[model samples]
Target: MKRALALVLSGLVMACAFGQGNPARGVRRPPKLQLFHEVNLSTFWHQAIIRQLAFSPDSQYVAVKLDPVLGTTELVIVEVLTGKKISTLRSPEYLGMSQNDRVQWLDNQVVFLGSYYRWNALSGERLADAPVVGWQAIFNQDRTQLATVENVLGTPSYLHVYDTKTWSDKKIYADGLSIGTIAWTSDDHLVMSVGVTRKSMGKTIAGHQIGRGPDVGPDVALLLFDPQSQQFIKSLWFPARARKTAKGIEWDISADLMLGISCFGSNSVTLSVNKILDGRTFDIKQFYSDQQVKSNSVAMVGGQACSADGRFLFIKDVDSWDGRHKASNSIIDLALSRQVASFPGGKEEIASSENGQFLAFGGKKGISIFLLNGE
Candidate 1:
């Protein structure tokens, strides 16, 4: 009887120590964020830099591409709420020897295009030892269709379309010598970078001027097409010729609004915007002048991203031609006509939501998201 009483007393003491004062059974609440919470997203995988990131349409998951390792790149889909990894999309079998070029959301699914590889996120499949040639664009608004402008090394250029659901492909055009980037303005219409002959280097094709530089090979402009008419409607200068080198055309979206950075003269880089209506153009405004941007100096030389809603433009500073560190980049709120934020630690890549509510960047400090709450 004495031993039984002693054991019962010990059990009571332990229960009181563990369960009496704790409201959550001792689990701790996360610390509150002053500016913003440093959400720990490091547990989804091992070491590898994420090059590009995009949130799903519903904002439930974030899809990202890791820097190449073991001659292969990994695509991960992470749950936003629980911070748990939902799926990893990767394949060394298809990539073979190509590197990751770019990835974007085609509606609900993900589509990635590499040097010679094209991947479908929903089916998680790749081309079987067959490489696709040239630059491609997805309707983005519609998930099923993809437009590719191909110019085989020595052959004339051709426009092709691929239906993601059935993998059924059909060539749209085969008469052009070279094509740049194709964007679908509507289901019945497409916008493509149409180039002129090699001789039209220093002249104007339509109202758009062409550069006369020694490196000037193909002079091209953006053209709108009506699938029903099977003819070009109008052509205009591709926003910036100076900014585009081997990487092809500057960043563009098919929405009604468009923004571009162009170098007009030997020393001026201009940021211009235009709104399209009924196949007609209206110049909204030119926000930045040559004084605000400089080549090989204040401006970054790589890919830039605008918010899906087209409010903010994030550009990475290239080099210190103007005596600034040239390492850190600035985020511009075009609607406000001012630079709102700067990331100074190191060079980074940025991607913003359509509404600019959330901004994501990749840098030496790892990937980070800045939540923009209107105060």
Candidate 2:
């Protein structure tokens, strides 16, 4: 019995001594993240960053979001084979003024999913027809039936949907709460975040700008919306005491539709990748931590795109100083690990692949493609 106990103790010591290397060691010395391809897109878009990027259904063409400061926003489509600009779709007034122009490739044609009207971002020419009020855009698996949002003025502001094929629109609303943003699940079910307008006030303690002007809103809670049943079945609340206030939460349904990532915060952030199965949502995964990433690294929001295979995610990290925010991107593979890889010149907008190929958004130099390998 003594010899057996001694042998077990010796094995335990050997295991501890030979334990795997530090698991918490972050991306200090991230491996290669090699260069796959780089293209010199046009130099017109400066201070201009890529917002949303998508590959065509056939995976031959690439569509990128172009935000040229003080200029209109354009969606530039390039042929992946030739690295040549094939087509450009611009956003119309009220839509292109800011950098929220979202250009998505559904099938053969690219559609602006955010608002209805489309315009020439460079020439300032109106592309689409009149304004599509309360209309939200969502694409099908084959990129058909662009889902749209339509605002219905009532107790609970309703959202209507329009089919891209027939141009027919329909209203979808629940009981309470204002409909903020809408998205489609993997199974083609609709989901949304519903919340009330909550206001908060803070007095000027010293001589600082103490939370009053454009930075105050009600405790924006999160709600899950179902378009089929037309109801908000679940609710999640944001932290009301943050210093910066709430900007609402963004949702990304995983490829399996069993998980999602919700971005919620004002100053300090909680970027949580959650799991939802069997009608229950659980916060199973997380990416960046406020204390670790936010404090030391540059933080920028707006463009977040996952890979086609749903194994990787891209986040637009930016730096803001004088009311202007400049951005770059990075890719994080949730499958291999919750580790991130950086591109040269500090990195901004990112788009990745399941096979480890990725595109990093470069301001004037165009887009850079690389493999997301650590070594």
Candidate 3:
């Protein structure tokens, strides 16, 4: 018996030293995230920075949010294949393209899902009839519908819903309440953060700013909305004090829970796991920070995005930030609940193409596009 026990002990030590018992030790790391494209903002143009990015339906083009020039806010379009500046939608200060802004393409024209009117992507014209341009635009589970407020200044308050096939909408009362973050729940419901209103504030026209503010959370809370019927649902509240980051909130959802990354600053973020049924908060304030990456890494909230098919969520985290920033994106497989891979991550904004073939990231400096190893 003593001899046998000694042998077992030896085996255990060997296993510990060689990582024989751990499931993750021998697993292969994901392929390095390839650079699909890059926009260098270091030329004579000093004031311009990439605020956000959107890929066209066919993924042939990408829209850079706001200015290629500082004082002017234009919808800059770039061809994905050739990296050429194809066009600009002139200056429309309201077209922020931030996480809060939901503008999308429809009928070959730029329209938020809620089509009160449409903006032309090529012409740079804000046309009158959304009779196709449109979300300041948020999409539901299938991207079939979009939830947006009226874009035309002083237009009657309405929560617009575009069902892809037709328009389904209802007028709203609190349309002027600033929107911090907007997300979709598993039941196909809308979840968002309501912030202070601007009806009488500094800015004159203020309604199209939903999803652009900070998380109105000392505690994680949500103002639920039912789009099919166009009704505001009950507010759900939680106990976790929302950590302050910069701006924007990114969500990954399941049947009973939601994974929300609330951006506090460039360095601080919280991966708040919430109970779907009752709005309970499970704080992972140090989730990525305490992660086993180099220890000094930080995640950028704008870089947190899920694939359109909902299979994976990619988050950009920095490994180093001295002068030349070293960053990589962490791809989490939602169904399996594991970090399956890591890609490049330093870009300020990230968006996945409709077919998921390309991942795009944008920043003040410029934009970088990448592809998964196999693709």
Candidate 4:
């Protein structure tokens, strides 16, 4: 009976009709954020580091990738409401992989693209032998297709789309660009941040340096593409410093907004938002800046996530030298342009459910889930 219910829930999840409700609006008090549950990785193993987290499409479960110790990694599936471990898969070969190798959910099945291998979440089954050699991997809304970048030396980065059913892949788009974040906005259309290299360094693409140093690459611009026809659709808004390196990009499911981050040297990072419209243009706005967040010369916005309704944005401060470490994690109410709450020891990684009812955080400390109440 349990397996049967899971099968039914899986179908609903793929249809994107599992969770449907308007998220609560306005500023929510800190006290209203009740701790829904906590998953202590240390309890299962030693020196555990929660690297990546993703909520199931139906919001019934969460998949967590943890490095219990150096040179080892594991994927654990947990029931969200009960906080019970449903399944666990271990891979000793994934030693130095970071959160960039994410775990995705295709209905009830969990798919993980590791540094050198791919595996199933529940049964510990190996699906593919090749590693995803790219910056990031993203699945479509229905989980029928997967998209990744092929960044080979001395060649343009090519976008690869793989059909899950046939296991066949096709190189759709290729360009002399450094691709940052990649996502499928719809079944037919995809979004990505692409930037031109500063100069030709022989076999090496120039100006794509990530951490520290001068912003080598031209400013990254968000673009939309059609994977089926392999055609560039339109160019969206670019970041403020259109000549810096863009490190990350995220979509706010609730408000149809895009959040982008550009890192300057080793200490500074900027966050911006743009509302995606029906046409090609985007309504861009500079939402938050880390220029003033520095304390003792160590301040940076490590990670960020938005509620489904796009009312609240969660920002995590990493490497803050502030003695107190009081505002490690903060909740910003976008409508009011003010901070609502702050928490100490917040992780740099966060995730939210489609309905915006739950928020998940992962870090060296452990995993935490919070329930957002209506204001």
CA error at residue 344 for candidate 1, angstroms: 5.2
User: What is the alpha-carbon lDDT for the whole of candidate 2?
Assistant: 0.46
In the range 46-116, model 4's lDDT, one tens digit per residue, is: 75677777778778778777777777778778777666787777764673365456776766665564433
lDDT tens string, model 3, 83-130?
Answer: 677666654454444444543565444633233435677666676554
lDDT of 4: 0.56
Better of 1 and 3 by TM-score: 1
Q: Which candidate tops TM-score?
A: 4
Candidate 4 has a TM-score of 0.67
TM values, all candidates? 0.59, 0.61, 0.58, 0.67
Ranking by TM-score: 4, 2, 1, 3
Q: Please report, as a residue range, the 10-residue window in candidate 3 with the lowest summed lDDT.
A: 261-270
Worst 10-residue stretch by lDDT in candidate 1? 261-270
Total backbone collisions for each predicted model: 2, 22, 25, 3
Worst 10 residues of 4 by lDDT: 261-270
Return the top candidate by lDDT. 4
Better of 1 and 4 by TM-score: 4
lDDT of 2 at 227: 52
Candidate 2 lDDT over residue span 1-375, tens digit each? 546644654564345434534445442333344454566654564554555566565555566666645556667776544466776666554244343235555345534536565433323344555244554455544444445544443235556655666667566544434555555545444455444422213321112222343435333344445556555455444434433326455332221121122211100111332222112252334455433443434334534555544555556566666545454445555544454664444334554432233444544456665444332
- What C-alpha lDDT, on a 0 to 100 scale, does residue 298 get in candidate 4? 21
